[model samples]
Target: MKKHVAWHIVRACLLPAVLFSSRALADCAQDFARDNAYKPHAGAHRMHERKLPLSLLDGQWVPTLKQEIINTISEVVPPNATRITSDGLFGPIGLVVIGDRGWIRANGDAAWEPLNAAESKEILDGAFTSYLSFNRMSDLSCTRAEHNGRPARVYHYKMPSELQIGSHSEITAYFDDQTGLPVHVEVEDGNPRQRAKSTVSIAFDSAIAIQPPETAGQTPRAGNADPSGRRKSLYKHPPGEAL
Candidate 1:
């Protein structure tokens, strides 16, 4: 379990070290996001899937590489990043967070529930993998650069060969210049057919407080997120079909 105080540490640049997929992985990226109708211009596919320089991180693969990246994230990504968000092939995946706990609105239900510490750690992985759990991979990347108008540090690691040839997951984060609260967190799902990006830049502190429900019934109490516990698309149509 990530330390409960991990929430306090969240306000730092560590907002979104990573990004999601849903359903089975017969074809991970392709099938995982098929239920989502969003697709980028087929022309933009190449650019969207473009691999930024791997030199983003400082060193080559070492035995302690994963741990080293973890340490750097604990030091860098958080102190500067303000908000954490994810984007699927569709759009902003409905993940809301207040302090350390976050909620995923599943099954078209309006109600929201708290995410367990382990669950949150998986998403923010000190790297990115939206809905998927964080597993160590070889040849990860890290760097600090200005993306868009916002200045942020970026981190990403290689996806498995099976996911796709150019396939990888990455995120750029920004911090609220004034309060130092997280202002923006974004993830890039590298598929051109069904491009996905999730962002979280709104509702923080007193702006939008997400408290636990008074009654236990209102809270789904989903621990570690069992396969059966995940939320399916609200209305349900086949993958690639329009909502």
Candidate 2:
């Protein structure tokens, strides 16, 4: 009878271990099957699918406003630039090129020379992505307001950081009701002491290219002079001169 009791206790312990192992294996198999089945659906679900209805524009249209803002910003082709004056307006004031290397006219001559690439990169990166990330829209609330003499959607978004004194910042985006093209974006950082304001404007134009100048690979003109006149150093732009 004692031997029988010992055998029963050992059997009970073994049965639980066996059952637990089988259940764990079954759960892993089920997880694998679910992962395989959802692989195709995952891609489809990630895309933006819903279209906004026209009649919903009367009061605070949150989703439509958010989508429009995202679409406009995302459409900006990376590193797109053109010749602009020192004042930051596009024109033929001086030769300017933007790409892997940014170049500007040094002496107002037709000759295009390289700008300080590191400085330009810092400014551009800060102006675009860094600023966007610093003040991202946490909760988008839309309100109807007059934008450029037409009724448009004005969105209020919560500022991501505690440095901003106000609980939220306002983003006023003017969009064409029919075509959904964004005309302007306005953001206000609500501190009277804040000196810098963030604003980005988009313009559509057909002619923007970053073609290398004809003098890109040519030997330096100083090297072609008499050997005595040519400087021995290979450095193109020396210190104290603007790059």
Candidate 3:
């Protein structure tokens, strides 16, 4: 399989921080907006996600990357610092971001490589925009429901063509009514050849410190000067899609 290495890292670590799909409903819009405004001083998040590809004949979902499973633990400190550890389809990966600078390491490597401008832009620019940006999609519907026995709001919407990964893509999201926080999200994308689906669940921690990992060296990876060159990533975000 052809892996979009950089895309994977971007998705595996940061995508869970951005979730949900919505538009139209005034209450949903307001609630989702509040979620976007949330930026806690310190906390930790745990996410688990599974992805599968669909077969044409029977519409059965099959494992494309050997039943890819992504588990991430992200911790944040004051002043926007974050450290994410992810066990992705490829292996283990880590990312750290402090202000405008970030570093990435893969496969339990000791050294952390700093992200270049273009690469950093690609990963961070939209990493947290999905929920806020999806409000632009034209057709969105919402309903009130219960999740985990708590009041919740549900939203289902199709991604805009420009943001789609395949012939079409759709998302369903659940938000906590009391807290205005996203609890779960599901996404499905497909084309004539195959279909893909990803589901993620989130949990938060009240206290955690996000610090850079100690490493022996900081040498750059060969061939990475070219942004398009093959490398590595984990969560596997598709190109051209909104985070």
Candidate 4:
């Protein structure tokens, strides 16, 4: 896994005047060293919940677009590997991010498929790469605070149009004050009305390898999952690949 033992330059997103000082940077790094160090291991895990924009689901088949999401349902692990899963509209979907390669355990016990196609970039991006990008701290400004129970700090940032979640404009993250591990995240979709909102939390991390259920169901393969099987090879990223 990627470990930052020394101080690396922080690519500040703002002007020098608002730049973080050396001491501040050190503190930030120290507070988040464990988090920053964990480039992701073969056993690390991540669970998140992201709500898609209602507009995207405005088609004839999915007309109503009720609040459905590929919700994450696991804890974030450290050091070795990470496995992520979500509740898809049809059933449940999962990704096993091991050895820097994304192996997807599509519905059923069909076979472990590798994400290597260009079109599968969205899945690859949202599955694991984005999870790594989410940890890039130099671009964010953080303040110390206590959230829930852990000694925590909050980092704030503005998302570009492409990175925005649905109609959200801002992103806020809560990290473990001591370990620097992210505990909770909130994406503000609306302000005045507080209509559509998105939130994700890192419930916990375990000191073990991530694995799929022993009795994984035996659902038949979909008649058509990217007819070209493009999703099987969408990306070639190890845990250490650049964001």
Best by lDDT: 3
Q: Write the per-residue lDDT of candidate 4 for residues 1-243, one digit (tens) a residue.
A: 000100011111101122233444465444433353333443344546675433222222221123334355544344334455555433355555443444555443244455445423433333333242332223456687888866887866544333333332566778776655677877654322122356776554455466544434444465644323432232221111221
Q: Write the per-residue lDDT of candidate 2 for residues 1-243, one digit (tens) a residue.
A: 122332232221111111112333454323322322212111111111111211123343222122222211212123533233321111112233354465543222224556566634533343223112213344444456665686654444444322244455554444444433344555554332222133545444334343545664333333222322322242222221210
Clashes of 4: 18
Candidate 3 lDDT over residue span 17-129, tens digit each: 33444343477656555664534532445445555644454454444433354455555454445666766543466777765777777644335767666655545444433
Indicate the TM-score of model 2. 0.32
lDDT of 1 by residue, 1-243 (tens): 122323333323233222332322334333322311212211110001111111111333122111111210111122111123222212222343334555554322223446776765543443221222233232333444554565543434343332246676555434333333333445554343333333533222223223433432373344433323222432122223321
Candidate 1, residue 25: Cα displacement in angstroms equals 33
Output candidate 2 Cα RMSD. 25.4
Q: Which run of 10 residues does model 2 get worst, by summed lDDT? A: 40-49
Report the Cα lDDT for candidate 3.
Answer: 0.55
TM-score of each: 0.31, 0.32, 0.65, 0.51
Please count the clashing residue pairs in each candidate, in the order shown. Answer: 25, 0, 5, 18
> What lDDT would each prediction earn against the true structure?
0.32, 0.32, 0.55, 0.44
**Pairwise TM-score winner, candidates 1 and 3:** 3
Q: What's model 4's lDDT at 218? A: 42
RMSD of 3: 6.7
| Candidate 1 CA-lDDT value | 0.32
